[model samples]
Target: MTSMDLSFRRSNLLRNQPIGRGDADPLPLLLGQLLLRAGLPTTIERASSRPWASALFEGRRHSIRLHFAGEEPTTQRARFIAGLSEAEWRLPKYFVADITVDEEGSDSEGQWVQLSALTIRDW
Candidate 1:
């Protein structure tokens, strides 16, 4: 009879290895483009994502917190918020089905906008 030895290794040793280049998720890039379209100096405070699926569709649901600094005039900020809700997104391999932007709150520092969106895979 022959015996075989199995060795174990630390998970962290493999964690830093690159699986592939350019295979990273494009969600961050898409979000950046959205902000750029708004033409506002925006800072992302927090973002969360979850996988979403239906009988025939699959995609992700994202909740993003954006901050517009006080430097921008109030009218411009209001226009940004209004336009963001109605703008059409042309993201690669993704289609934004629904989106909502709401004023979370504001202070002497900045204004906060909460954006919720549902993106469906196009491919």
Candidate 2:
């Protein structure tokens, strides 16, 4: 995976109070690390929410769209989902949010597994 520094908008501590727990800004970063550890060539791109999502869950503003590539598509997808499940387990205090992963075409690495995570800033 190529290395690059990416930054996202963080909620103001005193202003933007969250609507629920597990809305911290750290989930995506941890997710990226998980993808890397799985040995899948990956890239996490900071992204905006779907129009409908942005309208409904305005409080959860941070979205991360990560792409993973591997030789075996099924194995890689399973690994990623397992890692994400572990992450969700780590945050037992919060509600389990829905994360979406899809197959987005191929590159030099083989198959591209796209995962999007939407999280809220700490309030």
Candidate 3:
């Protein structure tokens, strides 16, 4: 398990909000921490939202796409999901809007993993 720092600037929309105040609040950060605790290399690139037709579509998902130092991406994904589910049960308040995991191949060869989440609400 390796730790990678994913640094990115948050949009003004997110900066002006309080901690865990909205759907797009702190899920990404919490998800990143969960991934790290699960022994996976996870990072949050950025977060933003879109407003349309009196609805607010927020991208609260932590997009984690990376190559592990010495691990298969598929295995990493599985572990991450499992860890996340467990963490979710332990911490019910923290929600992951949508989590997408991709494993192109099997075993520890040519495996690619990606995850993202979305938080939607009516504005």
**Considering every candidate listed, which one attains the maximal TM-score?**
1
Candidate order by decreasing lDDT: 1, 2, 3
In candidate 3, what are the lDDT values of residues 1-123, reduced to their tens digit?
A: 998544533653486643344444454455456556546344333434332222434333344553443345556645555644334422233444445554323333334455454433323
Candidate 1 lDDT tens digits, 62-113? 8888777747635545766776656877777788888887447776777777
Candidate 1 lDDT score relative to the true structure = 0.71
Per-model CA lDDT versus the true structure: 0.71, 0.49, 0.45
Clashes of each: 0, 0, 1
**Can you give the lDDT of residue 115 in candidate 2?**
56
Spell out the clash pairs found in candidate 1.
Answer: none
Model 2 alpha-carbon drift over 4 Å, by segment:
1-24, 45-62, 69-74, 82-96, 120-123
lDDT of 3 at 122: 28
Which pairs clash in model 3? 61-117
Q: Give the runs in model 1 whose Cα sits over 4 Å from its true position.
A: 1-24
Q: Which candidate gets the maximum lDDT versus the true structure?
A: 1
How many angstroms is residue 116 displaced in model 1 relative to the true structure, after the best TM-score fit? Answer: 0.3
Write down the TM-score of every candidate: 0.70, 0.42, 0.41
Q: Against the correct fold, how does model 1 do in TM-score?
A: 0.70
